[model samples]
Target: MNETRREYIKRINIVLDFIENNLDTKLSLEYLSKKAHYSAYHFHRVFLTLVNESLNEYVNRKRIERIAAILLVKPNSSLKNLAYKYGFNSDNSFSRAFKKYYGISPTKFKSEGKELLSKIGIEPFSSEKYICSIDNIKQWTKMNAQITIKELPELKLASISNIGNFEKAGSMFQKLMEWGHQKRVLDTSNFKAITIYRDNPNITQTSKVRFSACVTISENINTDGEINQHNLKKGIYSIGHFEIKAEEISKAWKSMSIWVIENGYEFRDGDYFEMYHNDHKTHPEQKFIIDICIPLQKTENIKLGEINNLDLSKYKDNLDYHQLISYMKELRLFFQKEYDTIFKLGKIYQGAPNFSYFSLTTDELKKQKLKFVIILNHKELYFSICLSGQNKSIRKKYWKIFKGSDWNKYHLAESIDNSLSIIDQTILKNPDFNNKRNLTERIEKESLKFINDIKNILE
Candidate 1:
């Protein structure tokens, strides 16, 4: 994270702490500024920069949100009493703010209280709603840090597109599944299904929204022009993963985006991709897993060099056979070189502080046949090549023990080297790479060259 973002998070936590403790008191800009350790004059702008909402707006919204919660469990609670408890002098003011935030007045919300109670803290609650105490807030915050922002290249997809709201997403996905089954296009063995949203829910009309139920297929799949094909453009993105009911997906998106802006990254305009690995169709509601990807574009004038440099050596020990192949591909693409033959064997895993794992195969070495293993997460990549039958036998002996276990299968050998080269090219292509004008600029230049060299050698 950048310095400005760090300051923003610090201030936000201070504000949240103060609000949680003093909900009944009048929250003023000057008072909150002191709590956040910022001058009153600059606090509003800073708060808006981090939260994407005005201070008064946030305070009022949060206040109403608290009132909404109180009405749920204590259904007999009086609106007037709740209003006063939340610092509203009269019910009228509280009702207006509540309606503005939730599209319903306090009394109406109480009458139809079930829906209002279901949605709290940007996520919707299910029939099994349970109030989360403050003690669990820190755990939630820690999980928030695991979210990451990434830039993904445009994907070519064959999908069944639908124009509707979130409410109809289930039906749309069902239709796509049926179509895939009939066409024999979806491979159940490789079940990485995704939904692409072309319109932003925050701005688009419910009926006019566009969504696509998609599945990744091999490039060789022939398109007869019957299936809808889309090119998702390459761009920076903010990504997060959550295991929750489908109804609560929106909450994850809101939280992830809020964190992104708080950390000084600007959200870019593009289709958001939600890859669903498990859902009610195959898994229980509580165990449903989904990965959300939001496109992001950096707004602040920050240089890549200023960011903390990633320690590459940490991954040396954990290098997997497949990752090693990817490294080789990077070197080939960037350096324009090729090895006569390569063999790898190892088990690699992701380690703490961005460390990764790799374990080598213990087999008699041969000039012709090579063996290696690359482990990444639950997946491992193993490769072997032999010029003679005896050499192949040696490779087979080590490969037998590694084949039966469950692992994420992938074809990483073809363009492994080229991929790393592209990243290096992107950094060096920046204008600041050559100008040693300042610390940030010099850092960008050196970082770009280093990345480029790494890519060149991997090939």
Candidate 2:
């Protein structure tokens, strides 16, 4: 992790600790400010900047979350008592806050006993959720599978209007199309389209499903004023082609929503029209091929982490571990020459005591003209160097670290191997460290042994 991200995580942990300790107390701005070691006036703003929520909003939201969880497990619990237990003075005030945040009365929530945890936006406590596994990225990418871009123009169409219940709108569109076909008014070549909802599903009602069953028509083939012309604004759209079975449309929608969030694009609150390219009518099995389009815009402060798309099989036998290590050392030296801040040179060994690993402080690391560290484990290597400061120069220096090499081709494992070798070499040659050579030799021998162990396991 870089310095900025590390500090941000540390601050969040401190804030969480304060919240946990003072959950039952009236947590005021002054108290939290002192706990977070910031001025009272600045604390609120800083907290919101880092966490995307105001202090009072976060505290109240968390309290409501706890209350919802309690209600689920203890359905017969008194609403009034629960409110007081979470630091609310009056039942009326608690109910108002709960309803505002969760869109349900506390009494009704307790009686209904539905899983209100997700409804209230409270995250479940699970270690799996915080594991930050690489598999998550793989699964997400596979489901979203890269889509092709297509530009479509203005379309004209006709449809039935529904008040609410957007999910039903799909069936309504199907009925309208069938009706049109029966009347011999709908042209199969006109292109089927459905103008579905653009509102919050959580708050929207079943009676108010806003939708339009429409189609694209040629200008020359005019219909008597009954059809509406939808000027389909032209822009870049990622179009995914998928055949949705009758029972799996909801799953498709959920996957699309996750893709949008992961890619840092806000869903345009407009009609997310889907084109039914083919349906069961043409092929007896009724496999419906849908073209799903989501509008996207780039926003500041949103960045996706590096995606691993390496094809490891291609380079399984051709990789040069030694050359890669030297290249990484050269890159580290280049960064040291270009940046002014502290750089930490560190080595971490596999299967070694934790105390054996040594890290340079941000101050000491930056003072060195050129420093590197490497850790050797039985079958793996680890390498890390710090480029200090939050300046543009520092960013530019680090950005060049991965340039001009086949670094992009190697997987995460290879990169770590190269990094560890450089760090180990640097620490071994350090004249100030009395036993540098012995330590380095031991690391190298242990790393080879670790590799043998891994090979044996694999075999």
Candidate 3:
């Protein structure tokens, strides 16, 4: 695509993100045009041409879709409240819009929840999928990319934004690298090429999608012309790593989304982007090794069924250190298996034999890590999750922010002198170590909760 088209995609994408994030608020042509850096008349004409919908129509349709998704999840939720939440002025107006968009009243759509989604061509994913035999999802993701959750650190980036084909990202990356090398800031060891996606392909035309090609930069840099600074906040991300030909990128993303929904995660409103890990030319098949990062949140009010058939009949009260060591290895292996099953791949930390914890990096840029630990002492078992191994100075910088935040849902780590390490509800006490099945279940459930709680604070 041409440079002009790229700029248009970049700007319109910013507007698209603004609209999605502020769905409950009133949006005006004047404000949106300002955001796009275009005259109101020109912005209106361009938006209609590129998006194939007038500003009002596009916003209203998105609002209606949001309501439909929510109504299906919360059937008893007040319709008037839901309408008002999505910017409807009155019940009559919301009802009219709902019918026009979905060909049914809000009340009727709620009653026929999954049916409503089918009629509107919306993919249906409910809490039931979370409980269904994991066979389908396991098969779906098995041959595809593996998915894992990690905490990303805040990044200082030098970026060039453009609208158009994603293939144009190469030019942007090249520009940043050239500039960085001239300024003596492009260190090969730590260099990273990333793309910040601004629009949803499902919602916006592919030709009009906006992307910001960015490279990690040293702290505080000056820029001129179209080069801009974007600070990416630290948070938890569901990362899908793929090594595939360019044509298969869309399938990789679809697999990532499917994994999230099937596993009962709600899409968090944030940037969706890709991080390129290797040069495509190096691969024999010319496949790109990229990590597709999507922000995610575990669904609220989800009730999981108990594994009643779990057998915990075997009990051994006493064992030699050799036997104890064998059990610890089994424990580590169990967690590794579970983590691999859910996250695709992760770095497991078994630093100490008595207490081995899996460490997930909070931010690769800052070298920070979150630790999930399992401790066993004969008849007793304990699980602890916390943040640790962060640079002390960096922890000092974020200490006030952590201190000012809520800690009701998490346990502050007891051993770490620095305040960065956090424990999850403290060590679980007296878990049935003899019952491996039940113990694994608790570890699986609690570990996820730990990850989620820490994400809330970091994000």
Off by over 4 Å in 1: 1-141, 165-168, 181-191, 205-208, 220-226, 298-459
* Candidate 3: stretches off by over 4 Å: 1-17, 33-54, 61-79, 95-134, 160-164, 175-189, 202-211, 219-228, 264-266, 298-459
lDDT: worst 10-residue window of model 3: 306-315
Instruction: Report each candidate's C-alpha RMSD, comma-separated, in the order given.
Output: 20.3, 25.4, 18.3
Q: How large an RMSD does model 3 have? A: 18.3
For residue 376, model 3's alpha carbon misses the true position, in angstroms, by 29
- Tens digit of lDDT per residue, candidate 2, span 217-327? 444232222223344555444454455565545444445545655555554423466667664466323656676666544355334322112222333233233323433
lDDT of 1 by residue, 1-459 (tens): 476665566566457546645778989999999987889878888878755678887677667756765565355788888788888887778888888877778788777756553453232322223325332332342333235455566565566555465666676567657766777766566566788875444333345345677775534354332245455678766666555665556656655655554566655646678887665555412445677887766655433322111233443345433344444333223322222232232323221112233322223333423323221221222222111112334434433422333421322222222121111111212222122245234333443344334323322
Please report, in order, the local distance difference test score of every candidate based on alpha carbons. Answer: 0.51, 0.47, 0.64
Candidate 1 has an lDDT of 0.51
- Name the lDDT of candidate 2: 0.47
RMSD of 1: 20.3
Which 10-residue window of candidate 2 scores lowest in summed lDDT?
347-356
